[model samples]
Target: MRLSLNQWTTRRWSVAEAVDGCVRHGLEAIGLWRQNVAEQGLAESVKLVRDAGLRVSSLCRGGFLTTSGKAFAEALDDNRRAIDEAAELEAACLVMVVGGLPGVQPGEPLTAGASRDLAGARERVAEALAELAPYAGERGVKLALEPLHPIYCPDRAVLSTLGQALDLALAHPEEQVGVVVDTFHVWWDPRVFDDIARAGRRIASYQVCDYLHPLPEDVLLGRGMMGDGVIDFKPITRAVLDAGYTGDVEVEIFNADIWAADPDEVVATMKARYEDVVLSRP
Candidate 1:
C-alpha cells in the first residue's frame, strides 16, 4: 500500500511546506485540512500538491451535527462547501469527523450528562450523514466516517468503534458512505480485525500512527510508531489487505511535540518508521 501524511502533523507549517516535506520524503500522498486550504486558497493549494506529484488521499474533515436550527443549517452549508473543495482538489475521499454531544462545542463548557447521551448523538450523526450522503455521491466523493477513539466520544465523535462505523456505512451503502480506519484510534480495539474484515473494500482510507501512551492528545508518531505501540500492525494491515483495501496508509499523529519540530524531519522519520514497522511486514 502507498504511504500518505496528514496535514494535522504539520499544522504549524503552510500547505506548501507540508507538501514539500511529504514529497521530499517520498510519500505517495497527503491529507489536507480545510482550515489550511482556506489559508492557502483552495485552488493554489491544489496546484501546489499536484505540481509536487502527490495524491490528495482525503480531506481532513467535514461534519458537525450537534445543534439544530440555524447552527445545523450552517454546518450543512459548510459541509457542502467542503465537498466542492475536495472535488476541486481531486481528493480520493472526504473524511468525516462526525460531531458529538447535543450542545458541546470544542473547547467549550461541558454539560453534566453529555456523555450519557451517546445514543442520541450517534442518531444525530447518522441522520446528518444520511442527509449529506446524496450530495457527496452526486459529486463522486466518498464520505469516510472516521470513528474517533472513546477518549473523544464525550466531546468529539460518538462513533468510537470500527464496528459502529461499518454499521453506519452499511446503513447508507447506496450513498457511497465508507469507513476511515485510523490505527491510533482503533489499534487497541479487540474487534479491530473482525471489523476490518467486515469493512472490506468499503474501507475508504487507512491511517497510521503510534502513541507512546493512551492520552487524550499530544501523542507523537515516533512514540507510537507502528510496532513500538502495543498494536500488532502487521496483522491489522494483513486483515485490511485481505479484505481488498488498496488505499493509502495515511500517517496522522496529533502530537504537539512533533509539530514543534521541523516538518521535514517529522516526515522523514515517519516514512522510515512506517517502512520498517508497517511496510516491512507480510
Candidate 2:
C-alpha cells in the first residue's frame, strides 16, 4: 500500500514540518492544504516538497460553488487560484468540497427552520464544474469532488455520496473530473463498493479515516484514527484497489486528540494503523 499522510492528519504541523515528518518517517508522499502552502510561500513549498522528494497525493480543497450573484463569481475565482496552487505543487488531484445550502448566514445555525433546497445547491455545483473542469484540465489538474457525510448536508457540502459525485463527474472527461472515495464519507453508502467499481479510472483519490463513535459536538472534527472507530477498511481498501485506482492513499484524520499529539507519533500511529487495520484483511 502506498501510504500518504494528509497534512490535516497532524493539523498543528506547518507545511515544512509535515514535509520533514514525511521524510523522517520514510513516507514518499504527503497531501497538502492551500492555507499552509500559501503561508510558506508557493515557490518555497514547491522547493520544499521537491527537496524532500515528497509527492503531493492530493491538494486539500478547491470547491464551494453554492453561492449566487457576486459570491458565486468570487467562489469561481477562488477555485481558479486553487487550481493554480495544485498545479504548482503537482498534486494528484484537488479535493473539491462543494459548499452546502446557500442561504445559511455566517454564525447562523444550519438547522434553522428555513428549508434548504439541497438539489438546487447541487445544481450550482454542476454548473461550476462545467466552468472549472475545462480550466483545470488545461492546467493539468484534476478536480476530485469529495462528498461529505450526509450529516453535514445542510452546512458543509451538498455532495453526500460517492454515487452522487460519480453522477456529476459523468458529464466531464474522466481525466479532468473525478470522484473521491473518502472512507469517512462513503463508508455508510450502501452502494459504496458498486460505485467505487463504477468510478474505476475516474477515482482520483482515496482518503481514509474513521468515523468516531459517540458523535462529538463538532462533527467536523469527529474523524477518528483508523481502528479507533468502527470503519472496516479491508473491504473498502480492496474495492478501491480492485477498481484500478493506482494512487497514494491518504490518512486524513481531523480528530482534535490526534492533532494535539506529537506529529511524529501521529505519523507512526498512521503507519501502524495502515499495516494493521487497513492492509491486514482476514
Candidate 3:
C-alpha cells in the first residue's frame, strides 16, 4: 500500500522538512499544498521532494471557478499556473475544489444577487473544466475534482457528491479528468459506496480523514485523524481498492489541534492509524 502524508496534516512543517519527515516515517508519497510550495519556490520544492525520493500523490487544489467577470478570469489564470506547477512536480493529479455560489457564507442564509444562482455556478464550473482539461492533458496532468460535503455547499464547493464529480469527469477524456474520494467528505453520503464502484479508473485521488461530531465553529477544522472519528475505514478502503485505483492513499487532515502538534509526532500517528484502519482491510 502506498500511503501519502498531505502537507496540510502537518501544516507547521516547511516543504523541505515535510519531505524529510515523510522519509523518516518510511513513506514515499506526499500530498502538497500550494501555499507551502509557493513559499519554497516551485522549482526548489520540486527538487527538494525529488532528492528526498518522495512522490507527490496529488496537488492540494486548483479551482474556484464559480464567480464571473475579471474575478473568474483570474481564477482560470491561477488554475493554469497550478497545472504547470503540477506538471513540473510530476504530481499524480491537480485536485480541483470547484467553488460554490460566490459571496455565500457557510452555514448562513444565502444572500440574493448574482452569486445566488447555484445552477449558474455549476454551469460555470463545467465551462471552466472544459477550458482547463485540455491544458492539463497536454502537460500530462489529470484534473481531479473533489466534492466537498453538503454542509460546505453554500460556499466551499459546488460539487457535493462522488457521482456528481464523476459526471463532470465523464465530459472529458478519462486521462484528463478524474474524481477524488475523501472519506471525511463522502462518508455520510448514502450513495458513496455505489459511487465508488462506479468511479472505477476515474478515481484519481483518495484522501483519508475521519469526521468528528459537534463540528468546530470553523467546520473546516473538524477533520479527525483516521480511526479517531466515526468512519469505518475497512469497507471504504476495500471499495476504493476494488475499484482498480492503484494510487497512494493520502492522509489529509485540516484540524487545528493536529496542526498544533509536532510534525514528526503527527506523521507517526498518521502511519499508525493508517495501518490499523485503512490498511487492515480484508
TM-score for each model: 0.92, 0.96, 0.96
Model 3 spans > 4 angstroms off: 105-114
Residue-level lDDT tens digits of model 3 in 41-143: 9999999999998999999789989988898999999999999999999999999999889877555676665276888999999999999999999999999
How many clashes (backbone N, Cα, C below 3 Å) per candidate? Answer: 2, 0, 0
Q: Pull out the clashing pairs in model 2.
A: none
The lDDT, on a scale of 0 to 1, for candidate 3 is: 0.91
lDDT of 2 by residue, 107-203 (tens): 3675554447877888899999999999999999999999989987777788899999999999999989998999999999999999999999999
Q: How far is candidate 3 from the true structure (C-alpha RMSD, Å)?
A: 1.5
Per-residue lDDT of 222 in model 3: 92
Question: Per-residue CA lDDT of candidate 1, range 1-282, in tens?
Answer: 998888887768789888888777777799999999999999899899989989999997987776567877888889989888988898989999888776775656676644457677788777788788889988888899998877677667788899998998897763379998888788879998899998888999998877555554432233454555666677777888998888788877776677788877777788777877876364
TM-score of model number 3: 0.96
Model 1 stretches astray by more than 4 angstroms: 107-116, 214-223
> What lDDT score is found at residue 60 in candidate 3?
77
- The TM-score measured for candidate 2 stands at 0.96
Residue 268 shift from truth in candidate 3, angstroms: 0.8
